[model samples]
Target: MEEIFENRGLGLGLSFSGLNGIVTYYDYNLDDNQQLHYSLELTGQQVGNSFKALRLTEESTDMQSISKSGSGNSLEIDRILVSGTYRWFVDESLVWGISEGLFYGAGGGFGYSTLKYQGERYKYGSQHIR
Candidate 1:
C-alpha cells in the first residue's frame, strides 16, 4: 500500500517541507528603497528512501539512485532542513524584485526544499510606486 501526507505552517508565505509535511517561510522589506530584504522560504517534501536521498551506500550495493516503498504504520524518517534567502529590488519598494538563495547542511533523515513568496503583486513606475 501507499500513502501521502501534507501540512501547512502558519506564516506569511507558502512553504513546503516534509518527510511527510509541507512548510514555507517569508520575510518582508525593511527600508524605503526596498533594495534590501530579509526574505526567506522553504519547500518540498521527504518521501521514498532515505539512503538514496542522502547518497548512502553499502559495500554490497553499488552507488545508485534510491527509491523504495513499504507497508507499515510509521514513516518515522525525518527530513529536516533550514534555508536562507536574500532579495533585491529590480525596482524599489519591493514591488518589483528578484531573489536568490541556498539550502545547505541538509542530510539523512532529511530532504530538499525550495522557497517562494506569494500574495504580493508587482507594481511599476518610479514616483507612482508604493
Candidate 2:
C-alpha cells in the first residue's frame, strides 16, 4: 500500500492540489497450486477554475482460472482515477477556461526488458465544460 500528495504553485502561491492511493497484493497456494492477485488505485485533484468542476471514476475486474494441477485459481483487478478542470487565472480568485481541450498520451510495455511482447497502447480523451 502507498499514498501520495502533490501540489503545484506559481510565484510562491499554491495553484493546485492532488492526492492518490494505491494497493497491491499477490497470493499463492502451495497445496493447490492456485494463485490470487489483488490491486486498488484511486486519485483526486483540484484545480483553480471558475466553473468549479470535479470528476470521479472507478473500475473493477475479476478473473478465475484452473491451474495445471487441477486446482481453482482466481485473480482480481481494480483501479480508480479522477481529474479536475484546469483553471486559467486572469487575476486573484478570477479564472478563465475554454469549452474544450485536446489530450494525447502514449504507453508501452515489454517482457522482462527484452522487448519480447512489444505491446503498445495509446489514449486520447477530451472534456467539455458548461
Candidate 3:
C-alpha cells in the first residue's frame, strides 16, 4: 500500500451517441371486394468507443517512470423487415364510405425479418500494474 501511495494520477471518461431510422408501406385494392396491404422496412446501425491515457508515476525508491495505455471497441448492425396482409369482403356492399365494416371472409397474412451483427475490440500501448 505504501508503494501505491507514491503514485497520484487518475482519469475517467464516458460518451454515448446513436442514430437510427428507415421504412416504407403500401396498400392496394385488388377489386371492390378484395384488398391487399404490404409494407417493407430496413435499418442499419454503427457504434464505436475509445479510451486512452498517458501519465507519469514515481515509486518510493525515488525512481520515475512513464505509463501509456489505450483500449477501443467497435460494432456494426443491419436489419430488414417485410410484411403483408390480405382481406376479403363477403357481404360485398354494406357501406357508404368507411371501409372497416366490410370484412366478412377468411384472410391470410405473412411476415419476414432478418438481422446481421458484427463487433470488434482493440488494444494499444502497454503498462505495468502494481
Candidate 4:
C-alpha cells in the first residue's frame, strides 16, 4: 500500500513611491518523506532630483530541507543569502549638453551567505565599490 500528498502556493505584492517589493514563502513534503521550506524577498527603488537620480535594490533568500537517507537516517540542510546595491546617475544631456540621451552612474554592493549541514557551518561574503 502507498499514499501521496500535494501542496500549492500563491503570492502577491504592492508598491508605492517608485519602490516595489515582493515576498514569497512555501513549504511542502515530497512523496519520499523529504520536507522543504523556503522564502524569498526582492525590492527596488528609484529617487531623483533635478540633477541626479538614485537607484537601490535588495534581495534575500532562505531555505531548509530534511530528508531520509538510504541508511534510514534523517539529514537536514539550511542556507541563507542577502545582498543589496545602490547607484547614482546624471543625464548625459545635463552634464555634456549634447542631448545624446545617455547617463553615467557608479554603484556598489555587498552579499553574504551561510550554510549548515551535519553539524557544520560554512559562510561566505563579499563587498564592492565603484
Candidate 5:
C-alpha cells in the first residue's frame, strides 16, 4: 500500500515531503450566484528539503555503477494548469433540509510543465552521455 502511494506521488513529480503536505483547493463565487461561478485556481507545493528518488541499501548490488551514472543533483519540476468552467443549474429544491440541485457543466484545463535538472536522463533504449 505504501509503495502504491510512493509510486503515484513520484509519478506526479513530488517528493516524500510533498506526500505528507496538505493538499487543498479553493473555490470562489462570482458577484451573481445563480447563473455562474468563477474561480481562479492557485495551487502549488514545494519540498522544503532535498531528497533522493532512488534509495541505496548496504546489501544493494551495482551501487558503484548507479552512482557513477546519475549526476549528483536534485531534480526540480514546475507544472502550471489554468482552467475555466461554465455551469448551468437545471433545477434546485429543498428536501429534508437538504438542497437537491441539478447542474450541467463544461470545463477544461491546460497544464504546462517545465523541468530543470543537471543530471543524466534517459528514455527507452537510449542512454544520455551527459
Candidate 6:
C-alpha cells in the first residue's frame, strides 16, 4: 500500500535572570491505502539553574485503519498525553577542591494519558516526587 507522511513544527525561546524558557508546537499527518493518522504536540520548558527546572508537554493523536481484503473492517483510535516535570539543582563544595561547580539534583514528574478506541475509553495517570 502507498503511504505518505508529513510533519511541521515551530519553536521559540527566551532567557532572563538565569531562567530560560522554550515553547514548541508540532503538527503531523499520515495517509496510507488503509490507514490515516494525524497528530499535534505542544511542549514547553523553563530552566533556571542546573539544579532547578520545569517541563511541560502535551500531545494528541488520531488514527484510522481499515482492512482492505478482510471484511472491510475499520478501526479508529484517539489518544492524548500530558506530562510535567520539576527538577532541583544541588551544589556541593569541598575544601580539597576536588568537587567544584558540580551540578547534581533529584526530581520527579507526573503524566496522564487517555485513549479512545472502538468506542471504548481508557485513562491512566502517575505522579512522583524525590
* Candidate of highest TM-score: 5
The residue pairs that clash in candidate 6, if any, are: 51-88, 51-89, 52-89
lDDT of each: 0.33, 0.25, 0.40, 0.35, 0.38, 0.30
Arranged by TM-score with the best first, the candidates are 5, 3, 1, 6, 4, 2
Shift in Å, residue 115, candidate 4: 25
State the lDDT of candidate 1 residue by residue for 1-130, as single tens digits: 7864322223544332222233445444444223222223222224223333544434332121122223312213333354444443343332332332221222222344343332334467666556
Best by lDDT: 3
User: Residue 18's C-alpha lDDT in candidate 1?
Assistant: 29
Which is better, 1 or 6, measured by TM-score? 1
The residue pairs that clash in candidate 2, if any, are none
In model 5, residue pairs whose N, Cα or C atoms come closer than 3 Å (at least 3 residues apart or on different chains), thus clashing, are none
Off by over 4 Å in 4: 1-5, 8-10, 13-20, 31-34, 46-130
lDDT-better candidate, 1 vs 6: 1
What does candidate 1 score on TM? 0.28
Across 1-130, the per-residue lDDT of candidate 5 in tens digits comes to 3533111111133222222221223334332233333332222223222222233223332211212233564444444455556665554442323444555678776766555555656556867796
Per-candidate TM-scores read 0.28, 0.17, 0.33, 0.22, 0.37, 0.22
Error of 5 at 74 (Å): 2.7
For candidate 6, the lDDT comes to: 0.30
- Error in Å for residue 27 of model 2: 2.2
Error of 3 at 81 (Å): 1.8
Stretches > 4 Å off in candidate 1: 1-20, 32-76, 92-130
TM-score winner, 3 or 6: 3
Per-residue lDDT tens digits for candidate 4, residues 70-110, read 45443433222232222233444456656443333233333
Give the lDDT of residue 51 in candidate 2: 14
